[model samples]
Target: MTLGNFSRVTEFILLGLSDTRELQILFFAFFFLAYAMVLLGNLLIIVTVKADPKLSSPMHFLLCNLSFIDICCTSVTSPRMLVDLLSQRKTIAFEDCIAQLFFLHFVGATEMFLLTVMAYDRYTAICKPLRYTVIMSRQVCWVLVFACWAGGFLHSIVQTLLTIQLPFCGPNAIDNYFCDVPPVIRLACMDVHVTEWLMVSNSGLISLVCFLVLVTSYTFILVTVRVRFTEGHWKALSTCASHLMVVTLFFIPCIFIYLRPFSSFSSDKHICVIYTVFCPVMNPLIYTLRNNEVKASMWKLWQRYVEGRKRTVTFPGDTDHCILPAINSLLQYTSVIISTMKDKMHKVNTSTVSEFILIGLSDAPEVRFFLFVLFLIIYLVTMASNITVFVAISTDTRLHNPMYFFLGNLSLLDILCPTITVPKMLEVLLSENNVISFSGCILQLFFLVDVVGTEILLLTVMAYDRYVAICQPLQYVNIVSMKLCARLAIGTWVVGFFNSLLHTSLIFTLFFCASNEVEKYYCDIAPVLALSCLPTYSRELVILTVAGVLGSSAFVVTLVSYVYILLAILCMNSAESRHKAFSTCSSHLTVVCLFYGTTICTYVRPSSAYSPDQDRIVSMLYGILTPLLNPIIYSLRNKEVKCALGRVISQVRTTLTK
Candidate 1:
């Protein structure tokens, strides 16, 4: 075992996991599937954590970084291992082996620190819930993540530099699949006793310390949660369980492999596989299955994905197709028929002839002026933006298609939607005269219903138009003609008008003798129906049945159309085409979710859940915020709109300069 000076070997032959064909094939299949799962599960977690608002907390953010590291680690090793498993010659160039060694340790070390940071995050959240937000802010999270990367890189550099410098004279055979300190240093012609101690100190001791720190942090967190916070006991346990499982899976095998001397063990590759393969695959699954928020976000995204796939239209080329247009049309027709039938069952009893008091959103006199100014600005911006888009669509020849035509209608609705409620709200906020003539309330209700309904149907129409354009580009022009567009737009308004009229008439039929005090800022159906002293089952039934059927029909149509659109996009072979299609659909999908989400939460439930305070907030979101943001969302999304607006602005500037 005495040292001898000699020239280093430039290549090393790896013995690999197995040489027998059957075992190699089995290993290949197992490792291949494990690698794929690692990539897929980690990628999904990364995307979900980044995209979901609910998962924007500090712990999930750290989890996202961990996922990224897992992906890097798996990519570095698994693919190369898989390639070596298939190749006849299992030799790697010296430089390649060195590079692999560097990255594997780099990413692996980073993951250790990241898991430690995650433990700290959990401890802060559980032990100091009151100050969690302030303690683990975005800046702090980013700093912790940066520290992890920096520490890993520095640690890996030291290990790599030490291992690569040792002289290897003759024995160039490596007994493992990839380069590591133990096997590489074992081939050194000189005695490696000090090098073995150094490797153990760097890799083994660090992992051991991190493992101890992680365990101590969890122990304290569990004790604290159990003693002080009984309500969060199960959630704390679940979260800690996942982290402990991952930590144990990661650190124990690493300790076993590196804690001993450089003399290799027969079970080294299997232990390495435990940390390399099993830990990466389990990280995402453990977090997703254990965490409620992540699960909820994943379920929401999955629902959207599934609903999108249900109506996906496939081409014979590479796409999967679903028949949706005929089905969507049937649903719409069915909704209309049900509404018509319900209108016939309810008799109109005209009994309202007086004024009603408005409760208003807030009664603080000090904030009245601020509220007026704020809402006034919102209303003006909404009107101007919507009107601008409407004018642009009407005048621009480039946007003279069914999509923009429906968009024009949507713009018009956005304008009218806020107008019906905002003007009265401003006047009441400013003047404190919270009374409206009964006729005014009826008119407001009628117009509000009409605008909302028409917008719903119109969005469905736009979705259908997109479906045609994407799924059947050849038939787009013929299928979505101007005549059909006109008919669809006019028919939507007509249906909305009749539906509103029937509801308005039925609402007026009820005797409102119980005080004329409306508890909401505006005349919503729920609030108005609450004032009725007579048996209001007929009105409630009609409202529920008609609104439910029509809204469901419109929602289904919109969802189905987008599903087919997505299918067509996925079928497309070009990257640019897929990007463009997704870009277009994302804006529409956002608007759909915002509109439908608020509307459903507001109306789909019983009157018992109606809180004036909650209603005001929900109404503010869909009613004011949505319309205000709609034009911005659309204009930003559509390149043509932005270009056209730029041209208009440029033209105005030139004229002014002249």
Candidate 2:
């Protein structure tokens, strides 16, 4: 069918679980907490399984994959559902609905097949102990995982193709939180009886076959255990119990929903929540609480972290007692600043504007397309490299020192900085829809300021770390205790939050009646302030004052630390020692120069000096290019990071080939 004949509806309204305001609020809180738990629990499992040498078995490997799938599956629907529960309109665009349907089934079916494979794994380990290793070797495990993913892809493509080609000329209300095969197929313009049955057979038969196989595998394993009646048998049975519980929770909901025609039964939406929301939340809890090995590994990891925190060094005449008072005074001053800003905002005149137009990078179509592709590649590489560094530092205990800890924070900031701006820029480039609501503009500026401010403080702290490591080598461990590191990290974030809040509150309080066109692709302080009708002298003065104090202080500290570091390096008798010392700081110094150079050029100048074209290029250097280069700089220059990354890569390779 042509585009005109495909569908008349541009979007679909979702009637979520309830219409009552009280019920919606309650459900929102419930699901928000549940989603947070699902993410944290599954991530902990993945990290623990990777970090601990004790969890190198094939069973644990499969469990790690299962945890990853749980995260992917829940993320597909939970975020959208949570947003809808809070939203009044609760609508999804036509293309978004179809994409959701595709990934929902793709990851869902993949999990089902993986669970069945885990069942088979258990059966071999228990019933065929003599040949278990031979049968379920590393190569065989890789093949099984590959097969599961391939099967899931095939299954999802068939469903998506069938549903996408159907004509939905009108009536685009879906009576559930998300898009799915049955509910979506029911909305077709033509009769869907044949399509419904075909989809049902496709989904239902797979669930049934997997369910039956799991059942038979468990049954045989149980019988074998009863006959053998050994200590090893008892342990295997305990492991099987966790898997069985997960299997029961997951498959029962799949069978109940798919093994029928498309109908709007009252229980349909509720049952969908079981496999979609409940299963992912419960999987980690079931495995960790029931399986001894996982529990032990988690406990060890926690103990190590706690022990590191507790090993604080004490020195004679130390002023540690004064630290708490200083922090308390700082917090009190911040509260006063916030209150003063609120009062000032209330006194200012409010504007009538609701949205602003963003004049993107270029007007030509080809230029826009080129920018889109360029930024898209940058965004992907930034995310991949930063996530690799973050995960490497997290999962490898060797990289647990203060330097890597700060580097991990830097990686996280790199991830957040680009994520705050790039996706919207990509959308604007692709669709030429450059209008942003007032609230979105405020949020974008707020988070951008927060990440940048946090990075400033974090870099200063990292420089201090290097100074201590180089200048006070004997006292490095005692001075940079994990507790102090944690406190410093928290302090940076807290200060950054207040700093961003103060600037955002101050800027938005001014009336914005002059113009609605933002000169840059994304919202920033200079552009937004330039659009204000009222005199921005007070805001500008405040920005200058704060930037001077904070920026100068951080720069002085970093500069002084590096100066001392250079002196210490030059004084070293061994050339080899000097080279090693400087190598450790090179990556951070390069990043510092890139970040501060672009930031100072853009923000330190008066608003009257702002050139739109020049400002955009400068902003991209700090906002986009810096994040893309940070991890590459660290990975290439830092030997320990390289080794940790190598170990992570080799572990994955070994898993696939051993």
Best by TM-score: 2
For model 2, how does the per-residue alpha-carbon lDDT over 253-284 read when each residue is reduced to its tens digit?
Answer: 88878887776444388888898899998899
Top lDDT model: 2
List ranges where model 2 is wrong by over 4 Å: 1-5, 307-323, 334-658
Give one digit per residue, the lDDT tens place, for model 1 in 381-483: 9998888888878778998888888888899899999989999999999999999988788889889998888888888888888888888789789868886
Q: Candidate 2, residue 416: CA error in Å? A: 42
- How large is the C-alpha RMSD of every model relative to the true structure? 25.3, 22.9
Indicate the worst ten consecutive residues by lDDT in candidate 2.
Answer: 313-322
RMSD of 1: 25.3
TM-score, model 2 to reference: 0.52
Name the lDDT of candidate 2. Answer: 0.87
